[model samples]
Target: MSTFRLAARVLGLAALVALLAACATGPRITTEADPEADFSRYRSFAFYSPLAIESRGYSSASSERMKAAARAEMEARGYVFTTEKPDLWLNINAYTQQRTDVTSMPTVDYAYYYSYRARGYYVVPYWRDRTDVHRYTEGTLNVDLIDASRNRLVWEGIAVGRVGRSGDAAERGARIDGAMADIFAQYPYRAGMVPAPR
Candidate 1:
Protein backbone atom coordinates (compact mmCIF):
# COMPACT_ATOMS: atom_id res chain seq x y z
CA MET A 1 0.00 0.00 0.00
CA SER A 2 2.97 2.33 0.61
CA THR A 3 5.09 3.93 -2.19
CA PHE A 4 8.23 2.03 -1.15
CA ARG A 5 6.40 -1.35 -1.06
CA LEU A 6 5.04 -0.84 -4.60
CA ALA A 7 8.56 -0.06 -5.94
CA ALA A 8 9.99 -3.19 -4.37
CA ARG A 9 7.39 -5.44 -6.04
CA VAL A 10 8.14 -3.97 -9.49
CA LEU A 11 11.90 -4.62 -9.14
CA GLY A 12 11.43 -8.27 -8.13
CA LEU A 13 9.24 -9.02 -11.15
CA ALA A 14 11.76 -7.38 -13.50
CA ALA A 15 14.64 -9.46 -12.13
CA LEU A 16 12.74 -12.71 -12.60
CA VAL A 17 11.88 -11.89 -16.23
CA ALA A 18 15.52 -11.27 -17.21
CA LEU A 19 16.90 -14.52 -15.81
CA LEU A 20 14.18 -16.74 -17.32
CA ALA A 21 15.30 -15.69 -20.82
CA ALA A 22 19.01 -16.49 -20.46
CA CYS A 23 19.61 -20.17 -21.13
CA ALA A 24 22.90 -22.08 -21.50
CA THR A 25 23.49 -24.30 -24.53
CA GLY A 26 24.40 -27.94 -24.70
CA PRO A 27 28.09 -29.00 -24.96
CA ARG A 28 29.74 -29.01 -28.42
CA ILE A 29 31.85 -31.79 -29.91
CA THR A 30 34.77 -31.53 -32.42
CA THR A 31 37.06 -34.29 -33.69
CA GLU A 32 39.91 -33.87 -36.17
CA ALA A 33 40.93 -37.54 -35.95
CA ASP A 34 38.74 -40.63 -35.87
CA PRO A 35 36.69 -40.70 -32.67
CA GLU A 36 35.87 -44.36 -33.25
CA ALA A 37 39.54 -45.39 -33.12
CA ASP A 38 39.83 -48.71 -31.31
CA PHE A 39 41.81 -48.85 -28.06
CA SER A 40 41.30 -52.42 -26.81
CA ARG A 41 45.06 -53.08 -27.04
CA TYR A 42 46.46 -50.04 -25.24
CA ARG A 43 46.30 -51.21 -21.66
CA SER A 44 49.84 -50.24 -20.57
CA PHE A 45 50.51 -47.26 -22.83
CA ALA A 46 52.05 -43.98 -21.66
CA PHE A 47 50.61 -40.51 -22.21
CA TYR A 48 52.92 -37.95 -23.86
CA SER A 49 50.65 -35.42 -22.19
CA PRO A 50 46.91 -34.92 -22.37
CA LEU A 51 46.51 -31.14 -22.29
CA ALA A 52 47.60 -30.79 -25.95
CA ILE A 53 45.19 -28.28 -27.53
CA GLU A 54 44.00 -26.85 -30.87
CA SER A 55 42.03 -23.59 -30.77
CA ARG A 56 39.96 -21.40 -33.07
CA GLY A 57 38.92 -17.79 -32.35
CA TYR A 58 39.64 -17.58 -28.57
CA SER A 59 42.28 -17.27 -25.83
CA SER A 60 43.96 -20.53 -24.64
CA ALA A 61 44.93 -20.62 -20.99
CA SER A 62 42.39 -23.42 -21.14
CA SER A 63 44.71 -25.51 -23.29
CA GLU A 64 47.72 -25.34 -20.98
CA ARG A 65 45.60 -26.32 -18.04
CA MET A 66 43.99 -28.98 -20.22
CA LYS A 67 47.42 -30.49 -20.88
CA ALA A 68 48.23 -30.71 -17.20
CA ALA A 69 44.80 -32.07 -16.39
CA ALA A 70 45.01 -34.57 -19.20
CA ARG A 71 48.22 -35.91 -17.75
CA ALA A 72 46.58 -36.26 -14.36
CA GLU A 73 43.51 -37.81 -16.00
CA MET A 74 45.51 -40.41 -17.85
CA GLU A 75 47.46 -41.20 -14.71
CA ALA A 76 44.19 -41.57 -12.81
CA ARG A 77 42.95 -44.08 -15.35
CA GLY A 78 45.85 -46.42 -14.52
CA TYR A 79 47.84 -45.26 -17.56
CA VAL A 80 51.54 -44.43 -17.21
CA PHE A 81 52.83 -40.86 -17.65
CA THR A 82 56.28 -40.45 -19.24
CA THR A 83 58.43 -37.75 -20.84
CA GLU A 84 61.51 -39.86 -21.79
CA LYS A 85 60.48 -41.58 -25.01
CA PRO A 86 58.58 -44.32 -23.30
CA ASP A 87 56.49 -46.97 -25.07
CA LEU A 88 54.29 -44.18 -26.36
CA TRP A 89 55.37 -40.58 -27.03
CA LEU A 90 52.57 -38.21 -26.08
CA ASN A 91 52.75 -35.09 -28.24
CA ILE A 92 50.05 -32.48 -27.63
CA ASN A 93 49.86 -29.05 -29.28
CA ALA A 94 47.18 -26.38 -28.59
CA TYR A 95 46.11 -23.01 -30.03
CA THR A 96 43.21 -20.57 -29.38
CA GLN A 97 41.58 -17.43 -30.85
CA GLN A 98 38.46 -15.27 -30.37
CA ARG A 99 35.16 -16.07 -32.11
CA THR A 100 31.85 -14.22 -32.48
CA ASP A 101 28.55 -15.90 -31.71
CA VAL A 102 25.10 -14.30 -32.00
CA THR A 103 22.46 -14.38 -29.29
CA SER A 104 18.83 -13.13 -29.23
CA MET A 105 16.84 -11.80 -26.26
CA PRO A 106 13.65 -9.81 -25.76
CA THR A 107 13.86 -6.20 -24.57
CA VAL A 108 12.03 -5.13 -21.41
CA ASP A 109 11.67 -1.54 -20.20
CA TYR A 110 9.75 -0.25 -17.19
CA ALA A 111 8.56 3.31 -16.60
CA TYR A 112 6.12 5.15 -14.38
CA TYR A 113 2.93 5.55 -16.41
CA TYR A 114 -0.58 6.39 -15.31
CA SER A 115 -3.89 4.63 -15.89
CA TYR A 116 -7.32 5.52 -14.43
CA ARG A 117 -9.36 3.06 -12.37
CA ALA A 118 -13.19 2.89 -12.28
CA ARG A 119 -12.96 4.61 -8.87
CA GLY A 120 -11.07 7.58 -10.47
CA TYR A 121 -7.88 6.48 -8.67
CA TYR A 122 -4.51 6.66 -10.52
CA VAL A 123 -3.21 3.12 -11.20
CA VAL A 124 0.06 1.95 -12.74
CA PRO A 125 -0.32 -1.67 -13.95
CA TYR A 126 3.01 -2.12 -12.19
CA TRP A 127 4.50 -1.63 -15.65
CA ARG A 128 4.13 -5.02 -17.37
CA ASP A 129 7.51 -3.99 -18.81
CA ARG A 130 8.31 -4.86 -22.43
CA THR A 131 10.37 -8.06 -22.66
CA ASP A 132 14.09 -7.17 -22.56
CA VAL A 133 16.48 -8.33 -25.30
CA HIS A 134 20.28 -8.59 -24.78
CA ARG A 135 23.43 -10.22 -26.12
CA TYR A 136 26.25 -11.75 -24.04
CA THR A 137 29.64 -13.12 -25.15
CA GLU A 138 30.79 -16.55 -23.97
CA GLY A 139 34.02 -18.54 -24.49
CA THR A 140 34.67 -22.03 -25.85
CA LEU A 141 37.51 -24.49 -25.20
CA ASN A 142 38.72 -27.46 -27.33
CA VAL A 143 41.01 -30.40 -26.47
CA ASP A 144 42.52 -33.60 -27.89
CA LEU A 145 44.77 -36.62 -27.03
CA ILE A 146 47.09 -38.70 -29.23
CA ASP A 147 49.41 -41.72 -28.99
CA ALA A 148 52.76 -41.50 -30.81
CA SER A 149 54.24 -44.98 -30.83
CA ARG A 150 51.49 -46.40 -33.03
CA ASN A 151 51.97 -43.40 -35.30
CA ARG A 152 48.22 -43.13 -35.60
CA LEU A 153 45.95 -40.57 -33.90
CA VAL A 154 43.88 -41.80 -30.98
CA TRP A 155 41.28 -39.76 -29.07
CA GLU A 156 39.74 -36.26 -29.39
CA GLY A 157 37.19 -34.11 -27.49
CA ILE A 158 35.62 -30.61 -27.49
CA ALA A 159 33.18 -28.49 -25.48
CA VAL A 160 31.39 -25.12 -25.78
CA GLY A 161 30.29 -23.72 -22.42
CA ARG A 162 30.60 -20.71 -20.10
CA VAL A 163 34.23 -19.70 -19.38
CA GLY A 164 36.42 -16.74 -18.44
CA ARG A 165 39.45 -15.16 -20.12
CA SER A 166 41.24 -14.88 -16.77
CA GLY A 167 39.90 -16.55 -13.63
CA ASP A 168 40.86 -18.16 -10.33
CA ALA A 169 43.83 -20.48 -10.93
CA ALA A 170 42.35 -23.21 -8.79
CA GLU A 171 38.92 -22.73 -10.35
CA ARG A 172 40.42 -22.85 -13.83
CA GLY A 173 42.32 -25.95 -12.88
CA ALA A 174 39.10 -27.49 -11.59
CA ARG A 175 37.28 -26.55 -14.78
CA ILE A 176 39.98 -28.12 -16.89
CA ASP A 177 39.93 -31.15 -14.69
CA GLY A 178 36.16 -31.48 -15.05
CA ALA A 179 36.06 -30.88 -18.80
CA MET A 180 38.85 -33.38 -19.40
CA ALA A 181 37.29 -35.90 -17.09
CA ASP A 182 34.28 -35.97 -19.40
CA ILE A 183 36.29 -35.97 -22.65
CA PHE A 184 38.61 -38.79 -21.62
CA ALA A 185 35.78 -40.93 -20.26
CA GLN A 186 35.98 -42.81 -23.56
CA TYR A 187 39.81 -42.94 -23.68
CA PRO A 188 40.11 -44.22 -27.26
CA TYR A 189 43.63 -45.55 -26.96
CA ARG A 190 43.99 -49.31 -26.26
CA ALA A 191 47.76 -49.74 -26.76
CA GLY A 192 48.52 -53.20 -28.18
CA MET A 193 46.04 -55.20 -26.15
CA VAL A 194 42.86 -54.23 -28.05
CA PRO A 195 42.76 -55.09 -31.71
CA ALA A 196 41.09 -53.04 -34.44
CA PRO A 197 37.74 -54.26 -35.71
CA ARG A 198 37.68 -56.56 -38.76
Candidate 2:
Protein backbone atom coordinates (compact mmCIF):
# COMPACT_ATOMS: atom_id res chain seq x y z
CA MET A 1 0.00 0.00 0.00
CA SER A 2 2.92 2.37 0.63
CA THR A 3 4.67 4.34 -2.15
CA PHE A 4 7.96 2.55 -1.53
CA ARG A 5 6.43 -0.91 -2.07
CA LEU A 6 4.64 0.25 -5.23
CA ALA A 7 7.90 1.62 -6.66
CA ALA A 8 9.68 -1.66 -6.03
CA ARG A 9 6.98 -3.66 -7.78
CA VAL A 10 7.07 -1.34 -10.80
CA LEU A 11 10.84 -1.72 -11.08
CA GLY A 12 10.58 -5.50 -10.96
CA LEU A 13 7.98 -5.56 -13.73
CA ALA A 14 10.12 -3.32 -15.95
CA ALA A 15 13.10 -5.63 -15.59
CA LEU A 16 11.01 -8.66 -16.52
CA VAL A 17 9.66 -6.95 -19.65
CA ALA A 18 13.17 -6.06 -20.82
CA LEU A 19 14.38 -9.62 -20.41
CA LEU A 20 11.54 -11.02 -22.50
CA ALA A 21 12.00 -8.44 -25.22
CA ALA A 22 15.65 -9.43 -25.69
CA CYS A 23 14.65 -13.03 -26.32
CA ALA A 24 12.19 -12.29 -29.17
CA THR A 25 14.26 -10.22 -31.58
CA GLY A 26 16.25 -12.62 -33.79
CA PRO A 27 18.14 -15.90 -34.19
CA ARG A 28 21.77 -16.49 -33.30
CA ILE A 29 23.96 -17.30 -36.30
CA THR A 30 27.29 -19.17 -36.45
CA THR A 31 29.54 -20.07 -39.37
CA GLU A 32 32.70 -22.14 -39.75
CA ALA A 33 34.98 -23.08 -42.65
CA ASP A 34 37.89 -25.45 -43.18
CA PRO A 35 41.07 -23.44 -43.36
CA GLU A 36 42.72 -25.81 -45.79
CA ALA A 37 39.86 -25.78 -48.30
CA ASP A 38 40.28 -23.71 -51.47
CA PHE A 39 37.18 -21.49 -51.51
CA SER A 40 38.08 -19.99 -54.89
CA ARG A 41 37.81 -23.37 -56.60
CA TYR A 42 34.13 -23.62 -55.69
CA ARG A 43 32.23 -21.90 -58.49
CA SER A 44 29.01 -23.91 -58.56
CA PHE A 45 26.78 -25.85 -56.18
CA ALA A 46 23.81 -28.21 -56.22
CA PHE A 47 21.31 -29.30 -53.60
CA TYR A 48 21.36 -32.85 -52.26
CA SER A 49 18.61 -35.18 -53.43
CA PRO A 50 15.09 -34.68 -52.08
CA LEU A 51 15.16 -38.22 -50.83
CA ALA A 52 18.12 -37.36 -48.68
CA ILE A 53 16.21 -34.62 -46.86
CA GLU A 54 12.89 -36.44 -46.84
CA SER A 55 14.58 -39.38 -45.13
CA ARG A 56 15.18 -37.03 -42.23
CA GLY A 57 11.37 -36.58 -41.88
CA TYR A 58 11.24 -33.16 -43.52
CA SER A 59 8.64 -32.46 -46.18
CA SER A 60 9.54 -31.97 -49.83
CA ALA A 61 8.14 -28.48 -49.73
CA SER A 62 10.43 -27.57 -46.86
CA SER A 63 13.40 -28.82 -48.82
CA GLU A 64 12.42 -26.74 -51.80
CA ARG A 65 12.15 -23.59 -49.72
CA MET A 66 15.56 -24.13 -48.18
CA LYS A 67 17.12 -24.90 -51.54
CA ALA A 68 15.58 -21.83 -53.09
CA ALA A 69 16.83 -19.61 -50.30
CA ALA A 70 20.30 -21.07 -50.49
CA ARG A 71 20.38 -20.80 -54.25
CA ALA A 72 19.61 -17.13 -54.09
CA GLU A 73 22.26 -16.53 -51.44
CA MET A 74 24.91 -18.54 -53.29
CA GLU A 75 24.19 -16.88 -56.60
CA ALA A 76 24.56 -13.53 -54.93
CA ARG A 77 28.00 -14.66 -53.85
CA GLY A 78 29.00 -15.63 -57.46
CA TYR A 79 28.10 -19.33 -57.37
CA VAL A 80 25.91 -20.95 -60.01
CA PHE A 81 23.59 -23.94 -59.58
CA THR A 82 23.97 -27.08 -61.59
CA THR A 83 22.35 -30.48 -61.53
CA GLU A 84 25.39 -32.47 -62.58
CA LYS A 85 29.03 -32.48 -61.47
CA PRO A 86 28.77 -29.42 -59.30
CA ASP A 87 31.82 -28.34 -57.37
CA LEU A 88 29.98 -28.17 -54.06
CA TRP A 89 26.98 -29.92 -52.50
CA LEU A 90 24.49 -28.03 -50.38
CA ASN A 91 22.43 -29.66 -47.64
CA ILE A 92 19.85 -28.06 -45.39
CA ASN A 93 18.44 -29.49 -42.20
CA ALA A 94 16.34 -28.17 -39.36
CA TYR A 95 14.98 -29.39 -36.03
CA THR A 96 12.93 -28.02 -33.18
CA GLN A 97 12.76 -28.80 -29.47
CA GLN A 98 10.60 -27.63 -26.61
CA ARG A 99 12.39 -25.83 -23.80
CA THR A 100 11.50 -24.49 -20.40
CA ASP A 101 13.42 -21.55 -18.95
CA VAL A 102 13.41 -20.93 -15.23
CA THR A 103 14.58 -17.54 -14.03
CA SER A 104 14.63 -16.03 -10.57
CA MET A 105 13.30 -12.50 -10.44
CA PRO A 106 15.46 -9.72 -9.10
CA THR A 107 15.26 -9.12 -5.39
CA VAL A 108 14.87 -5.67 -3.87
CA ASP A 109 16.51 -4.67 -0.63
CA TYR A 110 15.61 -1.68 1.51
CA ALA A 111 17.48 0.03 4.32
CA TYR A 112 15.95 1.81 7.34
CA TYR A 113 16.50 5.51 7.84
CA TYR A 114 16.28 7.06 11.31
CA SER A 115 15.97 10.73 12.32
CA TYR A 116 15.48 12.82 15.53
CA ARG A 117 12.71 11.50 17.89
CA ALA A 118 10.63 14.67 17.68
CA ARG A 119 10.39 14.52 13.89
CA GLY A 120 11.48 10.94 13.25
CA TYR A 121 10.90 8.91 10.10
CA TYR A 122 11.45 5.14 10.03
CA VAL A 123 11.70 2.84 6.96
CA VAL A 124 11.25 -0.93 6.69
CA PRO A 125 13.17 -3.24 4.36
CA TYR A 126 11.47 -5.91 2.27
CA TRP A 127 12.66 -8.86 0.13
CA ARG A 128 10.72 -10.53 -2.66
CA ASP A 129 11.76 -13.87 -4.23
CA ARG A 130 10.00 -14.73 -7.49
CA THR A 131 10.59 -17.43 -10.09
CA ASP A 132 9.35 -17.40 -13.68
CA VAL A 133 8.93 -20.48 -15.86
CA HIS A 134 8.75 -19.87 -19.59
CA ARG A 135 7.89 -22.55 -22.11
CA TYR A 136 8.87 -22.16 -25.80
CA THR A 137 10.14 -23.97 -28.87
CA GLU A 138 13.74 -23.65 -29.99
CA GLY A 139 14.57 -24.21 -33.65
CA THR A 140 17.88 -24.70 -35.44
CA LEU A 141 18.59 -24.63 -39.17
CA ASN A 142 21.93 -25.84 -40.57
CA VAL A 143 23.37 -25.20 -44.02
CA ASP A 144 26.22 -27.49 -44.92
CA LEU A 145 28.54 -27.09 -47.89
CA ILE A 146 30.47 -30.17 -48.91
CA ASP A 147 33.28 -30.63 -51.41
CA ALA A 148 31.72 -32.92 -53.98
CA SER A 149 35.04 -34.32 -55.22
CA ARG A 150 36.35 -35.19 -51.79
CA ASN A 151 32.94 -35.71 -50.12
CA ARG A 152 33.99 -33.66 -47.13
CA LEU A 153 32.35 -30.76 -45.34
CA VAL A 154 34.07 -27.47 -46.15
CA TRP A 155 31.76 -24.89 -44.57
CA GLU A 156 28.69 -24.81 -42.38
CA GLY A 157 26.33 -22.13 -41.12
CA ILE A 158 23.81 -22.58 -38.35
CA ALA A 159 21.01 -20.41 -37.05
CA VAL A 160 19.17 -21.02 -33.78
CA GLY A 161 16.25 -19.10 -32.28
CA ARG A 162 12.90 -19.29 -30.56
CA VAL A 163 10.10 -20.72 -32.68
CA GLY A 164 6.47 -19.72 -32.45
CA ARG A 165 3.48 -22.09 -32.25
CA SER A 166 1.57 -20.60 -35.15
CA GLY A 167 0.74 -22.83 -38.12
CA ASP A 168 0.62 -20.02 -40.68
CA ALA A 169 2.68 -21.05 -43.68
CA ALA A 170 3.48 -17.51 -44.81
CA GLU A 171 4.75 -16.43 -41.41
CA ARG A 172 6.89 -19.51 -41.09
CA GLY A 173 8.34 -18.95 -44.56
CA ALA A 174 9.27 -15.41 -43.65
CA ARG A 175 11.06 -16.60 -40.54
CA ILE A 176 13.00 -19.10 -42.61
CA ASP A 177 13.97 -16.45 -45.08
CA GLY A 178 15.14 -14.12 -42.35
CA ALA A 179 17.15 -16.88 -40.73
CA MET A 180 18.74 -17.92 -44.03
CA ALA A 181 19.71 -14.37 -44.78
CA ASP A 182 21.45 -14.14 -41.45
CA ILE A 183 23.25 -17.41 -42.09
CA PHE A 184 24.46 -16.72 -45.61
CA ALA A 185 25.60 -13.23 -44.76
CA GLN A 186 28.54 -14.89 -43.09
CA TYR A 187 29.71 -16.76 -46.19
CA PRO A 188 33.43 -16.04 -46.53
CA TYR A 189 33.65 -15.84 -50.32
CA ARG A 190 32.68 -12.88 -52.46
CA ALA A 191 30.83 -12.80 -55.77
CA GLY A 192 32.31 -12.26 -59.29
CA MET A 193 35.66 -13.85 -58.55
CA VAL A 194 36.03 -16.09 -61.63
CA PRO A 195 39.44 -16.58 -63.17
CA ALA A 196 40.49 -14.61 -66.21
CA PRO A 197 40.86 -16.17 -69.67
CA ARG A 198 44.26 -17.93 -69.93
Candidate 3:
Protein backbone atom coordinates (compact mmCIF):
# COMPACT_ATOMS: atom_id res chain seq x y z
CA MET A 1 0.00 0.00 0.00
CA SER A 2 1.31 3.43 -0.86
CA THR A 3 0.63 6.60 1.11
CA PHE A 4 -0.53 8.41 -2.04
CA ARG A 5 -3.12 5.73 -2.90
CA LEU A 6 -4.59 5.82 0.63
CA ALA A 7 -4.79 9.60 0.55
CA ALA A 8 -6.54 9.50 -2.84
CA ARG A 9 -9.11 7.02 -1.57
CA VAL A 10 -9.80 9.14 1.51
CA LEU A 11 -10.28 12.24 -0.61
CA GLY A 12 -12.64 10.41 -2.98
CA LEU A 13 -14.77 9.18 -0.06
CA ALA A 14 -14.96 12.68 1.39
CA ALA A 15 -16.10 14.11 -1.95
CA LEU A 16 -18.81 11.49 -2.28
CA VAL A 17 -20.09 12.27 1.23
CA ALA A 18 -20.20 15.98 0.49
CA LEU A 19 -22.18 15.46 -2.71
CA LEU A 20 -24.78 13.32 -0.94
CA ALA A 21 -25.11 15.83 1.89
CA ALA A 22 -25.85 18.65 -0.56
CA CYS A 23 -28.52 16.61 -2.31
CA ALA A 24 -30.32 15.78 0.95
CA THR A 25 -30.37 19.28 2.43
CA GLY A 26 -33.76 20.52 1.26
CA PRO A 27 -36.57 20.54 -1.32
CA ARG A 28 -36.39 21.70 -4.96
CA ILE A 29 -38.56 24.70 -5.66
CA THR A 30 -40.18 25.87 -8.90
CA THR A 31 -42.62 28.63 -9.72
CA GLU A 32 -44.69 29.99 -12.60
CA ALA A 33 -46.75 33.12 -13.12
CA ASP A 34 -49.01 34.44 -15.83
CA PRO A 35 -47.12 37.07 -17.76
CA GLU A 36 -50.18 39.14 -18.49
CA ALA A 37 -51.22 39.48 -14.87
CA ASP A 38 -50.29 42.67 -13.06
CA PHE A 39 -48.84 41.62 -9.68
CA SER A 40 -48.91 45.16 -8.34
CA ARG A 41 -52.71 45.16 -8.29
CA TYR A 42 -52.89 42.41 -5.73
CA ARG A 43 -53.00 43.89 -2.23
CA SER A 44 -54.96 41.52 0.01
CA PHE A 45 -55.10 37.72 0.24
CA ALA A 46 -57.36 35.02 1.62
CA PHE A 47 -57.45 31.24 1.61
CA TYR A 48 -60.00 29.49 -0.53
CA SER A 49 -63.03 28.04 1.17
CA PRO A 50 -63.08 24.22 1.09
CA LEU A 51 -59.40 24.52 0.29
CA ALA A 52 -57.84 22.17 -2.22
CA ILE A 53 -56.02 20.55 0.70
CA GLU A 54 -59.29 19.09 1.95
CA SER A 55 -58.51 15.84 0.23
CA ARG A 56 -60.12 13.67 2.91
CA GLY A 57 -63.55 15.29 2.73
CA TYR A 58 -62.39 17.43 5.67
CA SER A 59 -59.43 19.55 6.59
CA SER A 60 -56.38 17.44 7.47
CA ALA A 61 -53.57 18.13 9.94
CA SER A 62 -51.10 18.67 7.13
CA SER A 63 -53.37 21.27 5.57
CA GLU A 64 -53.44 23.26 8.79
CA ARG A 65 -49.66 23.38 8.95
CA MET A 66 -49.48 24.46 5.33
CA LYS A 67 -51.99 27.25 5.87
CA ALA A 68 -50.12 28.54 8.87
CA ALA A 69 -46.89 28.58 6.93
CA ALA A 70 -48.51 30.35 3.99
CA ARG A 71 -50.04 32.92 6.28
CA ALA A 72 -46.69 33.80 7.77
CA GLU A 73 -45.07 34.11 4.36
CA MET A 74 -47.92 36.20 2.91
CA GLU A 75 -48.01 38.62 5.83
CA ALA A 76 -44.23 38.91 5.77
CA ARG A 77 -44.54 40.06 2.15
CA GLY A 78 -46.98 42.82 3.15
CA TYR A 79 -50.09 41.01 1.97
CA VAL A 80 -53.06 41.63 4.23
CA PHE A 81 -55.10 38.61 5.22
CA THR A 82 -58.71 39.29 4.50
CA THR A 83 -61.90 37.37 3.89
CA GLU A 84 -63.86 40.00 2.07
CA LYS A 85 -63.01 41.52 -1.30
CA PRO A 86 -59.52 40.15 -1.32
CA ASP A 87 -57.36 40.68 -4.38
CA LEU A 88 -55.82 37.20 -4.28
CA TRP A 89 -57.19 33.84 -3.14
CA LEU A 90 -54.81 31.11 -2.12
CA ASN A 91 -55.28 27.41 -2.85
CA ILE A 92 -52.54 25.32 -1.26
CA ASN A 93 -52.25 21.55 -1.27
CA ALA A 94 -49.74 18.81 -0.60
CA TYR A 95 -49.40 15.03 -0.93
CA THR A 96 -46.78 12.32 -0.64
CA GLN A 97 -46.01 9.48 -3.02
CA GLN A 98 -43.86 6.36 -2.79
CA ARG A 99 -40.74 6.58 -4.92
CA THR A 100 -37.68 4.52 -5.74
CA ASP A 101 -34.19 5.57 -6.82
CA VAL A 102 -31.63 3.28 -8.38
CA THR A 103 -27.95 4.00 -8.66
CA SER A 104 -24.96 2.04 -9.97
CA MET A 105 -21.28 2.64 -9.47
CA PRO A 106 -17.97 0.92 -9.94
CA THR A 107 -16.15 -0.33 -6.86
CA VAL A 108 -12.95 -2.13 -6.00
CA ASP A 109 -12.74 -5.23 -3.81
CA TYR A 110 -9.36 -6.18 -2.43
CA ALA A 111 -7.74 -9.02 -0.56
CA TYR A 112 -4.36 -9.30 1.14
CA TYR A 113 -2.10 -12.32 1.64
CA TYR A 114 1.31 -13.02 3.19
CA SER A 115 3.72 -14.74 0.81
CA TYR A 116 6.01 -17.01 2.88
CA ARG A 117 8.42 -17.57 -0.01
CA ALA A 118 8.96 -13.87 -0.59
CA ARG A 119 8.38 -12.96 3.07
CA GLY A 120 6.33 -10.04 1.91
CA TYR A 121 2.69 -8.91 1.90
CA TYR A 122 0.90 -8.96 -1.44
CA VAL A 123 -2.48 -7.43 -2.38
CA VAL A 124 -4.95 -8.47 -5.05
CA PRO A 125 -7.67 -6.10 -6.21
CA TYR A 126 -10.90 -7.00 -7.93
CA TRP A 127 -13.07 -4.49 -9.79
CA ARG A 128 -16.82 -4.79 -9.99
CA ASP A 129 -19.99 -2.76 -10.37
CA ARG A 130 -22.43 -2.18 -7.53
CA THR A 131 -26.09 -1.27 -7.78
CA ASP A 132 -28.26 0.16 -5.04
CA VAL A 133 -32.03 0.58 -4.92
CA HIS A 134 -33.57 2.93 -2.37
CA ARG A 135 -37.20 3.47 -1.55
CA TYR A 136 -38.49 6.74 -0.09
CA THR A 137 -41.50 8.94 0.35
CA GLU A 138 -41.58 12.00 -1.92
CA GLY A 139 -43.72 14.93 -0.89
CA THR A 140 -44.99 17.62 -3.27
CA LEU A 141 -46.55 20.88 -2.17
CA ASN A 142 -48.36 23.31 -4.44
CA VAL A 143 -49.29 26.89 -3.59
CA ASP A 144 -51.53 28.65 -6.06
CA LEU A 145 -52.58 32.29 -6.07
CA ILE A 146 -55.63 33.29 -8.07
CA ASP A 147 -56.92 36.71 -9.04
CA ALA A 148 -60.13 36.93 -7.08
CA SER A 149 -61.70 39.51 -9.37
CA ARG A 150 -60.95 37.57 -12.55
CA ASN A 151 -61.35 34.11 -10.99
CA ARG A 152 -58.15 33.00 -12.69
CA LEU A 153 -54.93 31.56 -11.44
CA VAL A 154 -52.09 34.04 -11.62
CA TRP A 155 -49.14 32.31 -9.99
CA GLU A 156 -48.09 28.99 -8.54
CA GLY A 157 -45.21 27.73 -6.40
CA ILE A 158 -44.24 24.11 -6.04
CA ALA A 159 -41.81 22.14 -3.90
CA VAL A 160 -40.65 18.57 -4.14
CA GLY A 161 -38.64 16.85 -1.43
CA ARG A 162 -37.89 13.55 0.25
CA VAL A 163 -40.11 12.97 3.27
CA GLY A 164 -38.98 10.88 6.20
CA ARG A 165 -41.51 8.46 7.70
CA SER A 166 -40.72 8.98 11.37
CA GLY A 167 -40.86 12.31 13.14
CA ASP A 168 -42.54 14.06 16.08
CA ALA A 169 -45.41 16.46 15.42
CA ALA A 170 -43.18 19.49 15.92
CA GLU A 171 -40.49 18.07 13.67
CA ARG A 172 -43.02 17.46 10.92
CA GLY A 173 -44.33 20.99 11.30
CA ALA A 174 -40.84 22.39 10.93
CA ARG A 175 -40.33 20.39 7.76
CA ILE A 176 -43.51 21.86 6.31
CA ASP A 177 -42.39 25.35 7.19
CA GLY A 178 -39.01 24.72 5.59
CA ALA A 179 -40.62 23.50 2.41
CA MET A 180 -42.93 26.50 2.28
CA ALA A 181 -40.04 28.85 2.71
CA ASP A 182 -38.27 27.20 -0.18
CA ILE A 183 -41.35 27.54 -2.36
CA PHE A 184 -42.00 31.17 -1.50
CA ALA A 185 -38.38 32.03 -2.16
CA GLN A 186 -39.13 31.50 -5.84
CA TYR A 187 -42.10 33.83 -5.91
CA PRO A 188 -41.29 36.93 -7.95
CA TYR A 189 -43.26 39.63 -6.20
CA ARG A 190 -44.41 40.91 -2.86
CA ALA A 191 -47.92 42.17 -2.20
CA GLY A 192 -48.85 45.01 -4.55
CA MET A 193 -45.40 45.22 -6.03
CA VAL A 194 -44.27 44.60 -9.59
CA PRO A 195 -41.23 42.44 -10.11
CA ALA A 196 -38.20 44.24 -11.40
CA PRO A 197 -36.77 43.19 -14.75
CA ARG A 198 -34.54 40.18 -14.40
Best by lDDT: 3
- Report how far residue 93 has shifted in candidate 1, in Å: 5.0
lDDT of 2 by residue, 1-198 (tens): 985868678787877897998877789899998877777789888986653456665666666777778889999888889988999898888888999999886565677777777577677666687788999999999999999999999999999999977789888788888889999988868544643333
Segments in model 1 whose C-alpha atoms lie over 4 Å from true places: 1-36, 44-64, 84-140, 186-198
Q: For candidate 3, which ten residues in a row score worst on lDDT?
A: 2-11
lDDT of 3 by residue, 1-198 (tens): 774586579659957985997777688888999998999989999998768888557876778899999999999999999999999999998888999988776666677899999999988766677788989999999999999999999999999989977669888999999999888888868888978876
What is the Cα-based TM-score of model 3? 0.85
Positional deviation of residue 159's Cα in model 1 after best superposition, in angstroms = 2.2
Candidate 1 residue-wise lDDT, 75-134, digit = tens: 676666655554544444533445555544333333454455554545344333344343
Alpha carbon lDDT of residue 35, candidate 2?
A: 76
Per-candidate Cα lDDT values, in order, are 0.54, 0.82, 0.87
Off by over 4 Å in 3: 1-11, 14-23, 111-121
Candidate scoring better on lDDT of 2 and 3:
3
State candidate 1's TM-score: 0.52
Off by over 4 Å in 2: 1-24, 50-52, 56-58, 107-125, 191-198
TM-score of each: 0.52, 0.78, 0.85
